[model samples]
Target chain A: MMPIAITDPDDPRIEPYRAVRERDLVGRQHRFIVEGEVVLRVLLQQSRFDIESLLLAENRIDSLSNALENLPPNVPVYTANRQVMDAIVGFPIHRGILAMARRAPLPPVEDFLATLPQEALIVGLVGLANHDNVGGIFRNAAAFGAQGILLDQESCDPLYRKAVRVSVGGALIVPFTRVASANAMVRALQGASFEILAFSPAGQEILSQVKPARRTALLLGAEGPGLPPDLLAQTRTVSIPMSGGFDSLNVATTSGIALHHLKSQRS
Target chain B: MMPIAITDPDDPRIEPYRAVRERDLVGRQHRFIVEGEVVLRVLLQQSRFDIESLLLAENRIDSLSNALENLPPNVPVYTANRQVMDAIVGFPIHRGILAMARRAPLPPVEDFLATLPQEALIVGLVGLANHDNVGGIFRNAAAFGAQGILLDQESCDPLYRKAVRVSVGGALIVPFTRVASANAMVRALQGASFEILAFSPAGQEILSQVKPARRTALLLGAEGPGLPPDLLAQTRTVSIPMSGGFDSLNVATTSGIALHHLKSQRS
Candidate 1:
C-alpha cells in the first residue's frame, strides 16, 4: 500500500486520531489505538487484531520501512509532519507511530477454557481497575508462558492504550477474555479440571510449597481489599511469605512472582 | 499534638505545601512529602525519618485521629478546609493527607554494607531512573525479606513522592543508600562477602536452578539497556527463563520474582 500524505490535522481520513487524549477517556467505537514504535511493530507482526490503519510522522517512515513492507496490502498508511501529527494527537509525537486496530468478539469463559492445552497455566484477575497493573500482569503472563488470562468484569480493559504500552505488546500477544464475575471464572476453570490457587495475604498455604496440578489457574485481586473473603473461603489460597510487617506488594508485581513460581515448577 | 486550623492558603506557616507540582519539579529543600492515609500511617509508626510537620484537610482529621494520636509530641499538624487545602496544594486534596519529613545523611556505601546480617538478601539497582519501577522494586525488596538496597547514582530516588506512594511505605521501611556507580556497588557488595548476581537475558544460570549464597545481592539494571556488559561480566549472572519470542518483564517485576526465588531457596 502507498503512504497517503495528510497535510491537515482536521482531515476526515484521520478523524480517529483527533484529540487522542479525549478519545481515550471515551470509548473508541470498538477500536483501540496502539502507540509508540515497539507496540506498533508488535501489532503489525503478530497481534490477533485486524489493522484498521496506520498513522506515522513522515520522518519515522524510513526507520519503520522494514516493518511497513510487511503490512497487509489493504491497510492504509497515513503520514504527517511533526506539527500536523502533534495537532492530530493533541500531544507531541515523540515515538511517532500509532495504529488503529479492532478485535473480534472474545470467546465465552467456558469455551475459552475448553480450548486450552491439556496441561496449561493461566492467570485470573479480580477487581483490578488499575491499567498499569493489568498491563504488567499481561507482560508477566507472556514472559512466563501463562497461555491465557481471565479478568473478571470489574477489571479494566487490557486494550486500553496505557495498559498495552506497559505490557510492551504482551497485551496483543496473550489471549484474554472477561468473565461475568469472579465466581463464574472460578467455576469455569474448575469445570475445565484446572486447580485454582487464589493469592491473598491470609492464604492457607505458602506459595513456595503449594504443588500445583497439571492445569493451574493462579488468581489475584486488587492491592488492598485483596481477593474477597467469600472468594478466599471458596478457593485453596496461597500467600507469599512477607517480612517486616509488609503485606503489600503491587498487584502486578505479585502476579509476576506468582506466574514465575507456578510456571517454572509446573510438572 | 493539637491540630492547628489555617484559614488562608498562603499562610506563612503552610508555605511548604504551596504549588506542590512545581515544588516537585524543583527540589523540596532537604525534605520529602508523604501523601495519603496508608503511607501516613506507615510514616508515623515506623519510618526512620524525623517528621517535620503534616498538612491535612480539616474534615480528614477525625478519620486520622488514631494515627495522629501516635505522632511525636513536637511535630505540628496543620489542618485546612477543602478550598484552602486545594489552593495551597495547587490541586484537589483527594487523598486529604500529606506529611513533610527529613532524613539524616545516608551512610557511605561501605559503611552501609558493614551493617547487614550474615545471612542477608539485598537488591542492587543500576540506571533504573523510572520512579514507579524504583518504588515497585523497593516494595518487592521489603516483601521478600530483602533487608537493604543499593542503587547506582543513575537510579531515581525511591523517596520521590510518586515512588514512595507506589512503594506503599516500603520506601520508608527498607534501608537504602545510593553509590557512585554500578561498579563501585558491586565492589562493595563483594567486599562484604555478597555473591552479586546480575540479572540479564543472556545470563549464565537460570534463576530457579541457581543456588544463592548466604549473603546474596540480586543486581538489576534498567529495562531496555539491562546491565552494562562489563558489569554483567564481572558479576555472577542469572536469568529468569522466559518463553516464546518475549524477553521483557518490567524491571520492578523482575526484582520481585528474583527476590522471592533467592530468598525462599536460600541455604
Candidate 2:
C-alpha cells in the first residue's frame, strides 16, 4: 500500500481523526481510535474490526513499512509531519501513530454465551466505570485464556482509547457483549450452566480455597463500592485475603490475581 | 485548628502547591503531595511522614473538619475558592483536597531490610518509569502484606503525585528505598537471605508451582524490556502461564498476581 502524504491539518480525508480527545467525550459513532505502534499493529494484523485508515507521523512511516506492506490496498495509509499531525489530533502526538477502525456490532449476550465451549472461563464486570480497569481486566482475561466477557450497562467501554492502549490491545482480541444489569449478566451465565463467582471484600470463601466448576464466571465491580450486595448474595462470593486495614487493590489487579488462580486451579 | 482563608492565587504562604503539574517535572525537595479524602485520611492517621500543610477548596474544608481536629497546630491548613485553587494549581483540582508532607530520609537499603520481621515478603521494582504502574504495584504489595519495597535506579519515584494517588495511599503506607541498580537490589535481598524471584516471560519455573521461602522478594521489571538478563540469570526466575501469542500483562498486574500467589503459598 502506497503511503499518502497529508499536508493540511484540516484535510477533509482525515475528518475522523480531528479533535480526537474532544470526540472521545461525545461518541465515536461506531468507530474508535487506536494509538501507538503496538495497537496499530494489532488492528492491521489481528483485529476483527475493519480498519478505516491510518494517520502516521512522518518518522513512523519507515519503521512501520513492513507492517504496512501487508495491509489490503483498499485501506488508505495517510502520513503527516509532526506539526500537522499534532494540530489534527489537538494534542501532541507522542506515539506518532493512530488508526481509526469501525467497531463491529456487539453480539447478543445469549448468543455470545452459547458460542462458548462447554468448559469455559468467562469474566463479568459490573459498574466498573473506569476504562483502565475494564481494559486491564480484558488484558488479564486474554492472558489467562478466558473464553468471553460480559459487561453491565454501567461499565465503561473497553474500546475507549486509553483502555485499549492500557490493555496493550487485549480489548481487540477478547469477544465481549453488554447486558442490562448485573442481575441480567448472572442470569445469562447461570442459564448457560456457568458457575458465577463474584468478588467482594465481605466474600465468604477465600480466593485460594475456592475450587471453580468447569464453566465459571468471575465477576468484579468498582474499587470503592465493590460488587453490590444483591449480586454478592446471589453468587458464590470470594475474596482475596488482604492485610488488616488495606482493602484497596485496583479492581483490575484484583481481576488479574483472581483469574490466574482460577485458571491454574482447573484440573 | 482554624482554617486560614487565602483569596489570591499567588499567596507566598501557599507556594509549595503552586503550578503543581509543572513543579512535578522538577523535584519537590524532600516533600510530596497527597490528594482526595481517602488518601488525606490515611496521611493524617497512619503515615510516618510529617504533615507540612494542606490546601483545600473551600467546599472541602467542612468535610475535612474531623480529620483536621487531630492535626498539629503548627501544620497550616489553607483554603481557597475553586477559581483561585484552579489558578494556583494551573489546573482544575477535581478532588479539591491536597496535602503537602515532609518526606523522611529513605533509610539505607541494608539498614531498612534489617528492620523487617524474620518472615517477610518484599517487592523489588526495576525500570518501571510509569507513575500509575508504580502506584498500582505498591497498592498490590500493601494489599498482600508485603512488608517493604526496593526500587532500582531506573524505576520512577513511588512518591510521584500520580503514583501516590493511584496507590490509594499505599505509597505512604509501604516503606520503600531506592538502590543503585537492579543488581544492587537483588544483592541486598540475597544478602538479607531473601530468595529473590524475578518475573520474566522467559522464566524457568511456573509461578503457581514455585514454593517461596520465609524471606521472599518478588522482583519485577518494566513490561517490554523486563528484567535485565544478568539480573534474571542471578535470581530464581518465574513466569505466569500466558496464552499462546499474548504475553502482555501490565507490569503492575503481574506484580499483584505474583505477590498474591507467593503470599498464599506461604504457611
Candidate 3:
C-alpha cells in the first residue's frame, strides 16, 4: 500500500472515516468504522469486505508497515502528525492504525440457516437496539460455542464502530445475518428444525432443565421491555433461576449464561 | 417535604449538584449524579445514602410531588427550566429529575463478608476500570444470587454516575466494598473459609467441572488483559469452555455466567 501524508482535518478524502461518528444517525448509509491494528489486520485478511482507506500516525507507520507488507501496493494509506490525527478522531488513536471498510452484504434468512453447520447452537437477537449489548452478545456467543448469530430487522447494526469495539472483534468471527422480521426469522429457524427457546426472567422452564438438542436457538431481547408478547408467546420460554431480591441480568450476560448451560448439557 | 423552587443554576444552594460532569476527575471530592424518578425515589427510600440536593424541571415538580411528600422538610429541592437543567448537565436530562448524593463509605473487607447470609456466592473485580462493566457486574451479581461485590483498589468506582446508570440502579441495592490489594482481599476471603476461583481463559479447570461451595468468590479481571499474574496465582484458576477459534467473553458477562452456574450448583 502507498502511504500518503494528510495535514488537514477537513480533507474530503477522509470523508468515509469522518462519517463514522454520525453513522448511527444516517440510517440508509450502511457503512461503519473499524479501528486498531488487530481488528484492521483481521479484516484485511478476511477478503470479504471492501477496504476504504487506512490511517496511521507518521511516527508509528514503520511498525504497522511491517505488518501490512503483504497487502496490495495500491491500497491507500494516510499518515498524519500525532496531533493532527488525534484532532480528526476525537481521541488518542491506539495501535497507531485505523481502517474504514465497507460492510459486507448480509445473507438472506434462508442462506443464514443453510450456511450453519448441522447440529449447531445459535443465539438469536430480536429487537435489541443497544450497540454495546449487541457487541456483548457477540462476545458471549463466541465464548459459549454458539455457531452463529441471527439478527431480526429491528436490531441495531452489529458492524457499528462501537459494537465492533465492544465485541473485541468477535463480530468478525461470529458469522451473523439479518432477517426481515422476528417472526420471519423464527419461522425460518423452525422450518430448519431448530428448537426456538426465548429467554425471559419469568420463564417457567429453568434454562438448566432444558435437554440439549441437535439444533437450538436461544432468543434474546433488549432490557426494560423484553421480548414482544407475540414473540414470547411463539417460542419456548426459559429462565435462569436467580435469588429473590435480584431482578434480572443484562441481556448479553443472560445470553452467555444460558449459552453456557445449553452447550455444557450437550457435552 | 417542602418544595422550594429556585430558577438559577448558579444558586449557592444547588452547589452540590453543579458541574457533575467533572465528578469523575475530582479525586478527593467523590459525588455521583443519579437521574430518573424511580431511581431517585428508590435511593431516597433506602436512606443508606445522603442526598446532597435534588434538581427538577419546573413542569416535572408536580408529577413527583406525591413521591417527595414524605421526605424530611429540610431537604433542598432546586428547580430549573428545561433548558437550564439540560445546560447544567452536559446532556439532555432524562425523567426530569436528578439527585446528587455523597459517596457511601465502603464497608471493611471483614464487615462486607460478615454481612452476607450463609452460603454466599460473591463476585470479585480487579482492575476493572470501565464504569459500565463495573455496573454490569453489579447487575449480574444481583441477578444470579451473588451476595455482594468485592473490588480491588484499582477497580473503578461502582457508585460513579455512569456505573449507577448502567447498572439500572442495582448499585443502590447490591452491597460492595473496596480492598487495598488483591492479595489482601484474597487472604481475607481465605481466612473466612471461602474458595477463591480466579476466572481466566487459560485455566486448567473448566467451569462445569468445578462444583460450587457454600461460600465462593468468583474472581474476575478486566476484559483484554485478564487477571494480573500475581493475582491469578493467588487464586485457583478456572475457565468457562469456549468453542475453537474464539477469544474470550466480556468480563462482566463471564462473571454473570459464572455466578449463574455457581448459584445453580448450590441450590
Q: What TM-score goes with each of the models?
A: 0.97, 0.94, 0.89
User: Per-residue CA lDDT of candidate 3, range B152-239, in tens?
Assistant: 9899988887788777677876788999878888988998889889999988799977897788898998878888898787678998
Candidate order by TM-score, decreasing, is: 1, 2, 3
- Residues B23-68 of candidate 2 have per-residue lDDT tens digits of 8999798899999998898898878799999999999988889988
- Relative to the real complex, the DockQ score for model 2 comes to 0.78
Model 2 accuracy (lDDT, Cα): 0.89
Candidate 3 CAPRI grade: medium
Best candidate according to TM-score: 1
Residue runs of model 1 more than 4 Å from their true location after superposition: none
> For residues A1-267, could you state the per-residue lDDT of candidate 2 as single tens digits?
788899999899999999998999987878999999888887777677888899999899999999887688899999999999999999998989999998989888998999999989999999989987888898888798888889999999989988898788889988899999998998889899999889988889999898889899999999888888988878898888898687568888888999899889983
Off by over 4 Å in 3: A1-15, A22-24, A27-31, A45-53, A65-78, A83-95, A245-247, B27-31, B45-47, B50-53, B62-78, B84-92
Best by DockQ: 1
